[model samples]
Target: MKLPHDWFHADSEDKEMYGKELNLEMLSGHFLFSKNIEVYAHRNDATDDILCRHIDAEDLYTVVHLTWSMRPEIDNKHPTVEFHGSYDEFLQYNSKFFN
Candidate 1:
């Protein structure tokens, strides 16, 4: 049988740094209007950036690096959609910080 993906065990103790248990509070606090975003990894507790996937999008595997706007506008909603690409591409993009 095929093994499960690492993300499946994201809540496990071994997955702390790279993967984490889905923090509903964090999602709600950071992304107030985003109902379609499923956050997979929260890199640092100090920052608002998170690795997530668009639940309603066609490509579920597409990893997204999102930075939520600290200040929301009265009429316009804006959050910096920094990067949208494959998981490997996401890793490569963030490799500098890890390495």
Candidate 2:
């Protein structure tokens, strides 16, 4: 998925610094506002970025530990979430990163 302009992300600076492919081993996500939301994932066979696996939303700890690869925001209220970026760059970045 294509991320917005304000998405907050922490890429492997080492990899990017050396022009090497980043092996995204995992990602961590923490629930901030809602009880919990289930998000569906489709296995991808082709990509320009490194991705080992995809995790479900219920497994919030995975995102928290940064063990699941990229975490792009995908929610019904995504527009609202993206707009919430006004709160701060970090929140906006997180919203774009995790949603």
Which candidate's TM-score is highest? Answer: 1
- Misplaced by over 4 Å in model 1 are 1-35, 56-71, 74-77
* Decoy 2 TM-score against native: 0.17
C-alpha lDDT score of every prediction, in listed order: 0.42, 0.27
lDDT of 2 by residue, 1-99 (tens): 333333223355622521221222211332323323222121122222221112233223111222222433343321111111122343344455445
The Cα error of candidate 2 at residue 4, in Å, is 1.3
Model 1 Cα lDDT, one tens digit per residue, 1-99: 111222232243433432222232234344434446555554443434556656776543333233333333333212434456665565655664444
Which clashing pairs does model 1 show?
none
TM-score list, all predictions: 0.43, 0.17
lDDT of 2: 0.27
